[model samples]
Structures are given as structure tokens and as C-alpha cells.
Target: MKYVQLGNSGLIVSKLAFGAMTFGYGNIPSVYKVGQDQSQELVDRALAAGINFFDTADAYADGQSEEMLGRLLGARRKETVIATKAGNRMGPGLVQSGLSRKHLFDACDASLARLNTDYIDLYIVHKTDPFTPLEETLGALNDLVRQGKARYIGYSNWPAWMAAQAVQIQHERRWATFINGQMYYSLVGRDIEHDTVPFMNNCGVGLTVWSPLAGGFLSGKYTRDNLSDPNNRLSGFDFLPLDKEWGFTVLDAVREIAQNHSATPAQVSLAWLLSQSHVCSVLVGSSKPSQLDDNLSAVDLQLTSEETAKLNELTRPVPLYPNWFTTMTLDGRVVEALK
Candidate 1:
């Protein structure tokens, strides 16, 4: 139910964004099996619980995610902030994908029709298109805002350096720059901390965490002996690469903290991310209503400083290159002036 301004923008968004990624049976049948009836129930529950921000993508479930979300929201479409992405291949043809001016322009119009909305609250570049010129992508996105097709634009799953360059280009052109980002950040995956986190912090961009559960790895259902569950998405998708041994070590601590708070390990894992200042919202794309309810309750689970410290220290990403070099060379800000 808590809200904050999305990145640098004035538009307020819920701290927990309901992702419709699992709302339909498409390419990823195992994960996206929640049909219309169940999707309706889940969407209703999320809205009733005060979630006003919904996220989907043109690529998710082969665009069925967007369609189902549109149908589910129905008359309440205007009441929520709808975000969708392009640049991911929605079809087999070369012209059907990429961030080229041709593909992006056609993609936006297609997304609008699928979502059944006039303008997207936040339109995003789902993935990088290396073959396309950066200017072509940036200019096309700027045009989306200018034409009222999209109100804001952002990037997901992009490298920190590439994101910075895009921002520079957008700023130089006096166009709309990315105010928010959707990145894979979870208790099990802290890789973004080495670079992306600092980049977003300095750039004043808000972050919405995707795969906050590490593709269900942190659900506490998997143990050292039982690594794969046929019923879980990890068995099929297995996308987010993780250090399993390290994950178990962190999960042990998460379980203890969850026990102390009378909560589930999943909620504790989400609460750890929610406690982070840089995280504007955490996407919950659970197929099961019970699981979604569990995730929604995470906003209320406040971990103690001691608990938060334990989890942070356990899952902290090791400093890389200049990050380590810079920290090793800090000086002058000792106890002199303040004392």
C-alpha cells in the first residue's frame, strides 16, 4: 500500500508492482498457466489490496501477458499505472524485433492495441539491441513521449555503462531520459550491486526489482539434496544464474529471520529487498493467489536492523576492480570536522 515517486518523475507508484508475466498460457506454458479466470481473481486481489501499478511486457508469454492484463483491468485501466516493454522479439521475423526505428515504432503501436490503452504510463526498452544505432533507439523513444504514445521510458536488463551512455544521449538531445529501471535483483542475485546500484544512485533513477526471488530459488523449497523441483519454474526456465551453495547459506539465515518474525522465507527475502532505499518497487508475478498474498504481506514485514545486517552481509556482492580500489583509498573524512 506504500507509494513513492517513480525514479525522478513526479508520478507516484505503489511500492509493490503486480507483474502480469504469469497471466497466460503462451510460450512458457509451465510458468504462464494462469488463465483468464485465475488471472481475474489475482488481479482483483492485487487491486483490492491497494496495488495501483501493473507491469507486463510484449515478450512475456508471447504477448499474451499484455492481452490478459488488458482484459483483466477492463474498466479499471485508467486507475492503474500500466508499464510494458518492447525490443524483445514478439515474432519469428527479423523486422518483428530489435530497437530499430522501424521495429520500435511498429512495436509501440502494437503494444497500445494489445493493452487496449491510448498511452502507456511507462514504456520500456525490454532489452538492448546492439545491431541498432543508439541514436535510432533513443530518438525513437523520445518520439514516443512527444507523440503521447508513452509518458515515460526506461531500460531493463541493461549494463550500467550502456545505460549511462543512453542517458547522456537523451539528456544532450533534451529528450526524456530514463527515470526508472527494471532489473534482476534478489536475495540470491546481488550482482547489480557492483555497478548498476551505484549508477542508479548517482543518476537519481528508481529501481523496480524483477525476479526478486531469484526465479523461485529463494522460495526455501529447494535444499542441498533437493536441487531441482519439476513443479517449479527453475526446473524449466533456469534463467537467472545463481551460486546455489551460497544461496543455501543465505537461505539458512533467511529462514531463521522468518521464523523469528513468524513469516515465510519468501517474505523475508522480499522484505530484505523492500528495505533497500534504491528499490522503488518489487515485482510479484506469482501464479498462485496464496503466493501473491504472501508477497503482498512483505510490505508490512519490517526486519530488525540486526536481521537486515545479517542478510546484507551474507548476500553482499564482492567489490570489483575500481570499486575495491576506491574503497581502499578513502581518507580525510575521519572524525576531525564532526567531532
Candidate 2:
């Protein structure tokens, strides 16, 4: 697998990171219930395929996800870059969640214990806590780095403005700044491009994309004819919303490209994300090894400039107010002035 530096950080991670959200067996709603044995087999296959980055979260399966991932990696822990998230509700109490100092410290220790590791390669805040001050959350994350509990810090599911503010705060305080931002991004969902991608690119923060397949809608299993597959995750969990009309248009383009490359539509979808220069890694989770293998092949599926442009044109987001106004005002006029 190809390795790249995570944002401005010195740590290098595999472009295709294995997500362990599917590693637990439980009645958790919308979660894939794979047992330890199958999870181990999948992990082994990923490692054998050269994936060195693993992502998990304490909120997944009520923390069982991390435990299963830890057990599976076993002795190969040193060779992997393990990432986990906190700040989600882990229990019934109010104190059980949020990015407050108490919860972060408690959650970090719990994650470390469950993962059987001394330090987390990357510790991310799972979501924004409007109730808690951003300074408190960032300060706690900084302390984790200073204490050697977490090597680097990041945040997930945060608005672009908040993420940019956090980076500025950390710089001002001389604290550990975030090196990455994890968010839902895919061909069907190009919303992040409006702000998050631009902010991250300007601030030197890398992006780790989750739901690159739009939660399985772009997996080729779903089509205009076969819209509802009872066994599909999207049928039950449908997440990271997309405009179905436009989504199908993008899917058509992906299908054409997939046929040309002799690749699965899923691989084509993933390759599209990998083609973005700012994307550091794309997280792929699977209940079976075959699915993992298909995703791994995306790294080798090269899309030509024309094919890439076709997909881009089909799904590109419509320019919103200020952006459209700015483009209208400056784009042509600047060239005229230069002439």
C-alpha cells in the first residue's frame, strides 16, 4: 500500500486504513456484528495486503470494537498505526460523553487499556460538543500528547469553521495542533469540498475520509433497478445523506469507468477519493475479507484525466452564494485586467 505523511505531521500512514467498527459482536443497532475469529481473519488479510493503519472508536459496540482490534493485532502492534476516537456517549450518564477534560482523560485510559497499547498513534474527538468550551477540549487533547498518551490529535464530524478555529487556538497556545480531520466524503456527497476541504488544504491539515462509498450506495450492489437490497447496510442504516437523483448520475459515470478499467464500481468510487491530493487516507471497514480485498485494489486502479473529469462534472456541488458571487465578480475580470 502507498504511504503518505498525515498532514504536516511526521508520522506516515497507509493510504488505505482498516476500520475496526465491524470487529465486535453485539446487538448494537446498525453495527456489523462480526465475531472475534472472523475479525481476526479480516485483520490478518488487511495486514498481509500492506495496510498498516487501523482506525477504531470507543463508542463502537460500547468499546468492544477496540478490544477486538487489540486482541487481533496482538504481537504486530508495533508495526501498526492505531487510531481511535473519543467524545461520544459511552454510557448513560451525562459525564460519559463530550470533550470535557474529565471524559477525555477517562476515555483515553479506557481506549489504551482496550487496545493493549501504550500510546495512540492518532486520537480524534469523535464529534463537536457545543456545551463544552473548545478550549477545554483542545487543552485536554494537548495534555494527552504531552503525557505521551496520544501521539497526535484530530477531530471528526466537525464543521469547517470549528476545525479551523481549533487549529488557530492550538497554534496560539503552543499546544499540539490537529494534523488530520475525519469526515464523511464521497462522490455522492461532495459537500465538504465547499469549506472543509479548502480549510484543511489552507491550514496544512490532512483529511481521512469516512463513508467514501456513501455508506454502500456506491458499492455497485445498489442501482436504479435494484434500489432496495434487504441485506445491504444502506437499507437498514442509510447515512451521510445524498441527493438520489444526482447520486445515480454519478453512479452511471462510475459504472462506465469501472467497465473501462475492469474494476468494481466500489474500487472506482474509492479511487476517486484517493486521487484527491489532500486526502491522506480512506477508511474502509468490512464484514468479510473479500470486500476488504476489493477496496484494497482501489489503490492500484488508476483513473485517466478524462474519466476523472467526467465523474467530477457529474457530482460537483453547485456553487453557493458568497462563492458564486466571488467567482462571478473576479474570475473573468482578473483575466481582462491582466490583458
Candidate 3:
């Protein structure tokens, strides 16, 4: 249960961030049917397992998820890091969401009220709003920090260039910058490797990976044999669209390592992410305590270099365009190997 610094900030968060996305609305439209009692049990289990960071979104179950987590962790509020997002519709009104100052502040306050907390550990801009100027959005966020409403800021589901631009704007204006980035990154979704990963590495910003399992694709619970099960979470939601043929290749490799470690395939999948140096935290969300336990145990599963090498070989994507050109053009430009 190791803790890593959040970007360049002083706060040290756990290696796994419990995601509250699954806390509410089981399979309903926008609002899944998750009860409070069940939600509390899951929250208690996560904290008991040494998870210190939790993530939720304003739009999740129409904010019911935040409300539940707030009630669950409100007493020991200072002990954990609570992260939630803005830029999603809070209601039918046009002003209820987005990155504009109106929506940002309103959304933050609404989230705070629901979570039953005064300050948010990490407040993230859920997405980029081309309609709103970056200056306006960040200026409002900086105001939140100044007001002690939020300790740190972050971004999610944003492009590499947009993230870099926000950091630069903050620097020039001397405003608070986003020290962390929360986005979809995993063995199956390596698109960030080319852009987002490099930007975070160079800027000293941290990466909090969401959907690291590609919405349960890497869990090994989904196969041609069980795809039609009505109880399966991924049955209707085939989210984040995976390349099945390619995904199975990674799955086959994961099974081999899981067998070697005497662990489940899901544990091997998460271990693969934890083994990466750039990942500060991987978010895990579940509807059952058993599921959470499986994810928690992944922290202890260590894949040897040989095992990792094999998995990488099976899942690595073919380099595209400019990246290929650069590697080819720069090959052998410098000579020398040493210790």
C-alpha cells in the first residue's frame, strides 16, 4: 500500500484510487440503482484496504454517487483525498455545467454540498469546453483554491495539447496549475503513450488512470463463453470499444502470468499497470466487495521482468506516422552504450 506524491504537490495519495462511478445506478438510464447501505459497505471496505483516494463525477447518477460517498466518509474527511469532476450537466438548465466560471463555481458548490464537505481534495475539470476561454475556467478554479474550497486541481479526458496549454497559461499568469491528469490509460488503451504520458512526464504532473481495465475488458471475466450473461456489467455497455482480436492477445498473456503468480487474471492485469513507473494511481470501481477485494490484492502481485516483457510483446501497438519517421530518422545518430 504505497503512496505517491500527487504530481509535484506535497500530498501523497495511495497507489489505487477507489472509483465511485459504480456506486449508483446499476443499469438504469443515467442513474443506476445503487443503494446507500451497499455504497457504505463498499466505501468502508476500500478504506479498510488502505485506499485513501476516491473519485466521482457530478453527472454520475445525477450526483447521487457524490452524496453517498460524502455520507460514508464525512466523519473522517481529513483522512482521505476526495476527487470529483465538473463540466457535466447538473440539471436541465444550460448554465448548470461546462468550464465557464458560472458552471465551474456552481458545480463545485453543488458537489461540496452533496459530499457534505467544505473542501475538495482534488477538483477536476471533467472535459475541455471550446466554448469557454481557458483563462475564464482556470481563473475560476484558482479562485476556488484561494477560497480554500479545493486543495489541488486536475484535468480528465482532455487532449495532450489542451492540457499543456492550461499549464502554460497558469505559469504565465502565476495561477494554480493542474498537478495531476485523470484519463483512460491501460494496456489496451495506449493512445496516451504517444502524447498525454509524455506531457505529464515532462511537466512533473502525475497520472491517475481511470478505466485501466478498459471497462472490464481486461478483467478476464468477459469472454465469448460468457458474453451473453445478463448479469454481466459489460453486456449492454461495451464501453471504450476494444479491438477484440488484439484484446484477446493481451488476455492470453495475462492468463499465463496469472497462473505463474497463482493470482487471478484481473490481478495480473492491474499488476501490469502498477508496474509502470508513470502511473501514480489506478482507479478501481466495483459493485461487490468481492470485486473490490480482488482489485485490492493486485497491489501485492508483482510481475517479474520476464513476464512483463512477454505481456508488452503481446500488447504493444505498431508505431504510427511521425513517431515511426522520427525513430527511423534518429536511429544510430548517437553511438555508445555504458553503465
Candidate 4:
């Protein structure tokens, strides 16, 4: 039910964004089997729980996700902040993908059609397109805003350096800059802390975290003994790359904290992310109503400082080269004084 402004933008969004990746049936039949009826029920539950932010992508379920979300939202489309992504191959043709001007325009129009909406609340580039010039991509996105096709633009799965450069270009051109960055961030996958977090902090950009459960490893269903559950997405998809040993160690801490609070491990894991100040929202997708309910309840689960510290220590990322060198050479007294 909590809301926050997305980065420095005026747009206010729910802290927990309902991801519509499971809205339609497609290639991953096992993972995304929720049909229209079930999708509606899940959406209803999410809305009832005060979740106004909904996220989907044209690439998810081969565009079925956007179609189903559109159909379910129906009259309530204007009540929610809907976000979708492009730059992913929606078809087999080479021209059907990337952040090229042609692809971005075509994809945005198609998404609008599928979602049955006039303008997207947020349009993100799903992934980087090295072959296309950054200017081409940024210019096309800016044009979308100018034409009223999209209200805002963002990028996902992009390197920190690339995002910084794009922001600078947009600033120089006096165009609409990105308000947020969606990336994989979890207790087990703290890789974003190295550069992405610092870059976003410097640029005043918010973060939307995907796969906060570390592919279900932090969902409390997986253990050292039961690591292969056929029904679990991690067992089949394994999308987010993580250190299993480190993940399990963090899971143990989460399990302990969950027991103390009488909350589900999933809730504890999500609460850890929700407690972060820079994170604007955490995306949670589910095929079942109960799963959605569980995720929504995480907004209410406040972890104690002691518990948060334990989890943070257990899952903290190892400082990389420059960070380590700076910390080692810098004078602690001077840094303390500056702080």
C-alpha cells in the first residue's frame, strides 16, 4: 500500500509493483499458465490490496502478457500506472528487435495496441542494443514522450556506465531522462551494489528490482536437501545467475528471521528489499492468488534492525578492485569528518 516517487520524477507508484509476466500462456507453459480468468482474479486481488503499479513486457509470453493485462484492466486501465518494455525480439525477423528507431517505434505502437491504451506510464528498453547508437535509442524514446506515446522512459539490464552516458546525453540535449532503472537485485544477487547502485544514486534515479527472490532460492521452499523442485521456476528457468553456496547461507539467515517474525521466508526476503531507501518498487509475479497475497503482505512486514543487519552481513557483496583499493588507501579520519 506504500507509495514512492519513481526516481526524481513526479510519478508516484506503489512500492510493490505487480508484474504481469504470468498473465498469459505461452512458450513457458509451466511457468505462465494463468489464463484470462485467473489473471483477472490475481489483478483484482492486487488492486484490492492497494497496488496501483503494474509492470509487463512485450517479450513476456510472446506479447500475451501485455494483451492479457490490457483485457483484465479493462475500465480500470487509467487507475493504474502500467509499464512495459521493448527492444526484445518479439518475432523471428532481425528487424523485429533491438533499440533501433524502427524497432522502438514499431514495438511501442504494438504494445499500445495490445494493452489497448493511448499512452504507456513507463516504457523501458528490456536490454541493451550494442549495435544501435545510444543516440538513436535515446532520441526515439524522447520522441515517444513528445508524441504522447509514452509518459516516461527507462532501461533494464544495462551497465552502469552505459546508463550514465545515456543520462548525460539526454541532459545535454535537454530531453526527458530516464527516471528509473529496472535490474536484477536480490539478497543473493547484490551485484548491482558495485556500480549500478552508485551510478543511480549519483544520477537521482530509482531502482525497480526484478527476481528479488533470487529465482525462488529465497522463497523458503528450497533447501540444501531439496534443491530441485520441478514446480519451481528456478529448477527450470534458472534465469538469475547467483552463487548457490552464498545464497543458501543467506537463506539460512532469512529462514531464521522469518521464524522470529512468523512470516514467510518470501516476505522476509522482500521486506529486506523494501527496507532499502533507493528502491522505488519490487516487482513480484505470480500464477496464483495466494502467491500474490503473500507478496503484497511483505509491505507490512518490518524487519528489526538486528534482523536486517544479520541478513545484510550474510549476503553482502565482496568489494571489487577500485572499491577495495580506495578503502585501503583512504584515511578513515578524513572520510569520517567529511561524512
Candidate 5:
């Protein structure tokens, strides 16, 4: 696995991160039912593959995910860069959720204890909380960094406008700011390109992609002839709001590219993501070790310029509002230079 900086931070991390969301027994059997034995084996395989970055969250499997990951990593925890998130509903109490100071402080301790670590390599706010001020959330994160509870901070699933505001506040306050962002990005889900991509690029926030295969929709397991597979992860968790017909259309192109490169659909999809300059890492989760191995192989598969452009055009997101207007107003020479 190739290594890179976790955003602009001095810290180094693997380009392919192992997502431990599938470590514990989740609500769905396919997701949460993996036992400790299997998790250990998978963890061993990941380490062997040179995947040092492991991502989990407090909300995954009522925190069982952290426990399983901690237990599996055991003595090898020191060799890995563990990233986990907070700000999700962890309890029934009104104070149990959100990015308030109370929850963040308590949540950090809980995550540390669960992960069996003294400090989190990266602590993230899982989602935005309208009720709590960004100041409060960022301040708490800064304190955690200062206290050595979390070494770096970031946010997940946040809009660009709010994220830009957070970046400004952190810089102005001289507090610990964002280092990386973990978001759902795939060939079928390219909406973040309009705003989030530009903002992260300008602000120096790195992106680590989640669900890079659209929950297995781009794994070449689903086709027009076989739209529904009980064995597929999407059958249990179809969280991504992707149109099946559109996904199949995208899959057709991915499949064609895969054949030309002598690779799998999933490899082609992941390789396409790695081609993006703004992407720092891609998180690949799996219930089986073989699936993880397939994803790991993508780092070695290089797509040609023509293939990359074909996928780019096929999956390019439509420009939004002022972005389109801004492009329209650009000088022809400037456009030519960009081309």
C-alpha cells in the first residue's frame, strides 16, 4: 500500500484505509455479525497488506465496533493510525448526542477506552449539529487536541459552507483545525465535487472516501440481469441514495474499463477515485477477507488517461448554480489554459 500525508499534517498514513464499521455485530446480520475470530483474521490480513489507517465510529454497532477493533488490534495498535468519530446519538439522554462540549469530552474518553488507546490519531465530528454552535464544537475539539486526547481533528458529512466557517474560526482562534474529511464518495455519488471538493482543495483539507463502491453496487456483482443479490451488502444496507438504473449504467462503463485493464469492476472504480488529486485515501470495508484483498489490489492498477477521462465524463456531476455561471464568465483563454 502506498503511503501519504493525512491531509497537510506531518503524520503519514496509508492510501488505502481499512474501515472497521464491519467489525462488530450491527443491526443487520451481514454488517454486525462478524465475530472476534474473523475480525482478528481480517485485521491480520489488513496489516499484512500494509494498511495502517483504521477507521471506526462511536455510532457503529452501539460502540461494539470500537471494542472489536480494539480487541483485534491488541498489541499492534501502536503500529496503526486509528481514526474514530463522535457527535452521533450514543444514548437516550438529550445530552448524549451532538457536538456539545459535554458529549465531546465524554465521547472522547469513551472512544479512547473502547479503542484501548491513550490518544486518538484522528478524532472527527460525525455530523453537523444545528442546535450547537460550531464555536462550541470546534472549541471542544481544540481542547481535546491540546490535552492530548486527540492528536488531530476533522469533520465528516459536513456541508462546504459550514466547514469553511469552521476552518476560519480555527485559524483565527489558533486552535486545532481540520486535517481530513471522511465522506461518502463514489462513481455514483459525485455531488461533493460541486462545493466540498473545491472547498477542501482551497482550505487544505484532505478527503478519505467511504463506500467507494457505492455499497457494492460498483463491485460488478450487480448487473441488469442480477439487480438484487441476497448476499450483497446493499441488500442489507442500501444507505446510499443512488438510482439503480443510473448505477447500472455507470457500472456498464466501469465494467468495460475493467475488462480493458484486466481488472475487476471494484478495482477500476477505486483506481478512478485515487486519480483525483484532492483524495488522500479511500476507505474500504468488507465482511470477507477476499473482498478486502480485491480492494487492496486497486492501488496497483493504473488506468490510462483515456480511460480516466471516459469515467470522468460518464460520472461528471452537473455544475451547480453560480459555479456554472462562474464557468460561463471565464475568459476563453482561461478555459483553454484549464483544458
Candidate 6:
């Protein structure tokens, strides 16, 4: 139940955010589980465990995630912080998508109605909206804050440069700025280490990591040989683009550490993220109570410094372009070897 500041904002949020992406079903949603009753039970358990942040998206389950979250929150909605995303296509029409003022306004109202709440604690842009100008998107988001539709703003699945541009636009126009980052970060997928993580820390934005387990690969479910059956989401969706060879290498290191610590691979994977200084919160979604409990246990799991260094060595990314040049060129305060 540890808490941290949400980006630069003064508001404190739980380290583990309840992800409601699995709250719906049917043809539109690629991955959906836990119906209303089940979702309600999970919500209760999460709240009991001191998780006050809940995240969902309009496109999930065709707006079912929002509906379910709102219904479950009911009278206790004010006790928790609710965050949902926009900018994804909600319908087949041309105007039903992007960051246009029309879509932004309509989407917020729709989310508000669905959630049965007047205002959202944090509203995020789900992805880059190339069709709309950044200024237009920022203006619309600013209007939402003024109208009390949303209290704060955030962005997800955006590149470092795009995020920087958005922040610049906000600064120049005095528009609502993004206070947090909701991005895919995991022990197995260390791609964000190249740019996103550094940029986020520089901008003083809190990071709420999604897919901290690399879609169950770090959950200790699939191994080199055991991955034969392609039934699970990772096998079926093939999302987050995990590097199997590199992933297995990291998992071998994780196995040794987990054995020494008497923890699960999943727990070690999550603890690895929690150990990072820039990570403000980790978004975790589960279908069962047991799964949620196991995930929650990560907040208490502590990896020794030696274990962390070994994990980092196995998963560290190859520096790309300017990063290589910059590190090679920068002269900073260096410690001399003690003779």
C-alpha cells in the first residue's frame, strides 16, 4: 500500500493501479474477461488492499470497461481515483476517432455518463492522433479541465518526441499538461529504457507501467519448450513484441534470484520494476482473486542489490544512435578507483 506522487502533481496514488481493461467482451475486444459481478468483486478486493487508482479505456469492451467500473464504484466512487483514455476509434465513422475537439468532447461526456461520475480524476489520450493538430488536442483537453470534466491529463503509447512536443505546446499555451505516463514496461521488455524513461524523468512525469509482466511471459507460465501451445493472450495476440531469446536469458537470471529469495518469477519481475526510482505506479489486471493477490504481493517483495544488478545485465538494451554518442561524449563527475 505504498503511495507516490502522481507525476508532478501533489496527489498521492497507490503504487499498484487496478487495470480495468479486462472488464468487457465480444468481437470488438481482442482481450476481455471478468464480467460485471466478477469485476465488482475484484474491485472490492483491490479497494480493500488500499489500491485507490483504477484505469480503463473507452475502446475496451466497446465501453463496457467504463460502464462496469462506474457501476461498481457506485457510492464509493469518490474514494478512488479514476482514469480513462480517449483518441481511439469508438465507432466506424470518420468523426468517431482521433483527438479532434468533436471526439474529445463527445468522448469525455460519454465516459462521464458511462462511469456515472461528473468528473474524471485523470484522463489520458490513448495514442497519438496524427489527424488532429497537437494544439487542437491540447485546447480540447484544456477545455475539459475548465469545464470540470477531467481534473488531470496524461498520455499513453506515445513516443518521447511526441510527448515532448505535447508538453511544449501545453507550456506555451498554458493548457492542461500531462502529469503521468501509462506505457508498456516490463522486465522482459526493456525498450522504454532507451528514451521514454529518461524523457519522463526529465519532464517530472510520473510513470504508471502497464504490462509489467510482458503479458504473462514473466509470470513463469511459458518456457522455451512449454510455449508449444498457442492458446494464451501472448501466444494469440503476440503483443509487446517480446524477444524470446533475450527474454529467456533474463528469465534464467530471474529463476536463480527467485529461488534464492523464495519468490515467484512474476513477483521478482514486478519487484524489478518497483525497484526503479522513476516508476510511480504499476498497473496490474487479473481475472482471479488469487492472481490479484500474487500481483499485489510485489509491493512487499524486495530484491537484493546483487539480484538487481544481475537482472539488469541480462535485460539491458543496446544503446541506440545519439544515446551511444552522448554517453561517450558526456564528461561528468567521476569516482576514481581507491588505490
Model 1, 1-339: lDDT tens per residue? 899999888979999999988878876776888989999999999999999999999988888889989999999998999999999887789899999999999999999999999999999999898899989999999999999999999999999999999898888989989998899999878888889988999998889999898888888887887777676567788877777887899889999999999999999999999999989999998898999999999999999999998888887788899999988887757635666
Model 6 agreement with the true structure over 1-339: per-residue lDDT tens digits: 999999999878999999998888856333687787888889999999999999999988889999999999889898899999999889989999999999999999999999999999999999998889988898999999999999999999999999998898899888888999899999877788899999999998889999898888888877888775756667665657867987898888888888888888999999999999989999999977888988999899999998899888878888999999988876554523332
Candidate 4, clashing residue pairs? none
- Quantify all predictions' global Cα lDDT against the true fold: 0.90, 0.91, 0.88, 0.91, 0.91, 0.89
Question: How well is each residue in 209-326 modelled by candidate 2, as lDDT tens digits?
Answer: 9988988889988877666766656667875667777788778889989999999999999999999998999999998888999999999999999999988888888998888887
Clashing pairs in 1: none
Candidate 4 regions exceeding 4 Å error are none
Better by TM-score, candidate 4 or 2: 4
The model with the greater TM-score, 1 or 2, is 1
Q: Tell me how far the alpha carbon of residue 112 in candidate 1 is from the true structure, in angstroms, after superposition.
A: 0.7
Kindly list the per-residue Cα lDDT of model 5 for residues 261-285, writing each as its tens digit.
8899999999999988889999998
lDDT of 6 at 270: 92
List CA RMSD, all candidates: 1.3, 1.6, 1.7, 1.2, 1.5, 2.1
User: Tens digits of per-residue lDDT for model 4 on 161-181?
Assistant: 999999999999999899999
lDDT for model 4, on a 0 to 1 scale?
A: 0.91
For residue 252, give model 5's deviation from the true position in Å: 1.0
lDDT of 3 by residue, 1-339 (tens): 878998989989999999998666643532265678888888999899889999998888888889888989977788999999999777789887789999999899999999999999999999889889989999999999999999999999999899999899999999989999998988888888887888999998899999888888888888877866877766666668688877887888888889888898889989999999999999998887898999999999989999999887777767877878987887463633421
Candidate 2: where are CA atoms >4 Å away? 28-30, 331-339
lDDT of 5: 0.91
